[model samples]
Target: MRILYGVQATGNGHITRARVLLPALRAAGVEVDMLFSGRQPDRLFNMEPFGDYRTCRGFTFVTDAGRVRRLGTLKQSRPLQFFRDYRCLDLNGYDLVLSDFEPVTAWAARRQQVPSLGIAHQYAFYHRIPGTGSAPLLKWSLQLFAPVDEAVGVHWHHFNAPVLPPLVAPSPYPLTEEEGKILIYLPFESMDEIRYLLRAFPEYRFRIYCNIPAPETQGHLEFEPFSREGFQQDLCSCAGVIANAGFGLCSEAIQAGKKLLVKPLQSQIEQRSNAVVLEQMGLGRVMPSLETEAVEDWLALGSGTPSPWPDVATALATWISTGRQVPIQVLTRELWRAESGNMLSLC
Candidate 1:
């Protein structure tokens, strides 16, 4: 069967998930094409897995100094281009269109009267799960942004719902974490501010990944451009992670057993909610902004236990190949056990 997979390219999490699913789908003997939206195609890197992919000027949230600005987002979004692209996209000859919280393919599948399945963490919001952004408007935006007929939500826990555990890819290198090194990936914050923030903590080393022209290392801090190999290497070796409260990186930190300190982007319900849930679950520490106090507090704490990442990609691929006729709970439990690898059950 042929499938068109839609991935939201506004952030790295969606792309990271696609990396896991693309190979799994191929191994399951499913033919698939990919479409990325929200970010420009040139900004995407280390995208070797999706073969040839398509892109569009889909909507993206605009941020200023670590906060999402709703007004700016609307102003920046080229609605005319988005509409034209959506209307022109052809979805013929595809057995299914899978949306990973991506808008173009989701809308196209609906307009063209084709089967669409939304397999994403955002879909978990359809259920009464924890960590939902509070504002009703944000809630509505989540629903309308990526509309789909069928939903397959993924989360860190089942929450006694049909949600599956987070899709995490293991570190490609051996896990030899450096106790004094930390990985910083706060894309929304300014690099100069980050450098200033870490200056006080001269004892620890900081490796930051952001929109740098090239690699540059200074006293106590190293700044590098976005490279998948380099970023993963730093993450695997780092003793801790300092980043925004994004799902993908948090999942990676947990899987890799790295100490985590997160600052949720203001005005983003998802990030704020993620922070609350992280504190509630005792998974990580959260600060509203990148302040020195939070960093000091986090440094005083120990590296807590990280979650076990399940091999949901392959199992989900199998389920898709089998027509998704059975309830996903059966597959959810199957994959949850496999994630545990006979060590622990998700609480």
Candidate 2:
């Protein structure tokens, strides 16, 4: 079967997910082609998994110091170019189209009358999941941005919905936790600001990765560029993780049993919702902004227990191979039972 998978490049989560899912699909004996959008093609790294992928100038949100800059995003969107790209896109030969919240292929499939499936965390919002910060505008954007048919949502938990577990990168480095070692990945925040906020915590060592042009370090805080190998190594070594409330990183941290603290992007519904669910499940802590108080409070608390999650990538591939629809309840129950009994749902 031929598949055209669309991934959003605005954040690393979709890219990270593709890194695992693509290989699983290939192993299932399915031919897959990936179309990535949002960031420039040159900016992407560790792309060997996609294997001769295609890129397009896709729409992306602009952010400034942990908050979405609406005006800047509006100014940056090339609507005419987007319309042209939409019209020019061809999904004629593909048997199925799958999107990870990518607008290009989703819209293309909608217009061309091709079968489309959305497989991403964002789609979880379609159901009554744990969520907060609901604005009609952002809600509308989420719906219209990536329109699809018969969607499948992935989350840290099923939330008694059709949602499956998050698909994460396999542990590349063995878990050798270093006490007081923290991995900070707040890409949307200012470097100087993150540094300033973290300076007070001199007792702890931080390995921070952002969009730095080069690698550098300051005192106890180490700054590095986007390196998948280096990040995984540090993630494996660190005792905990401090990052933006992105599902990708938080999911990885949870799966690895690392203590997690997240600062959700301002005015972002998905992020706020993620934070709410995480906190609700007692899996992690959330800070409203880059405020030091929340950090102080979080640091005072002990690390939460890590919950074992199923290998969702392989399961998804197997499910896709079988045409019959299996309920997520059945899928999660069997997979979780097979993987580990120490579930956070135990609480």
Candidate number of the best TM-score: 1
TM-score of 2: 0.94
Provide the RMSD of all predictions against the true structure, rounded to 1 decimal. Answer: 1.7, 2.0
Segments in model 1 whose C-alpha atoms lie over 4 Å from true places: 137-139, 339-347
Work out candidate 1's RMSD over C-alphas: 1.7
State model 1's lDDT: 0.85
lDDT string for model 1 (4-76, tens) is 9999999999999899888999999999999999998889998887788998888889998998989999889
Residues 1-347 of candidate 2: C-alpha lDDT, one tens digit per residue: 88999999999998999888999999998899999999999899988867889999989999999999999999999988888887799997998888999998999999999888888888877777667435545546667999888777888766667777788866777877788888999999998899889988999999999887898978999899999889999988888889989999888898788888999998788898889988887778888878888777777777655555668899989887675388756876766455446664422
Q: What do the candidate models score in CA lDDT, each in turn?
A: 0.85, 0.84
Q: Please provide TM-scores, in order, for all candidate models, with all chains considered together.
A: 0.95, 0.94
Clashing pairs in 1: none
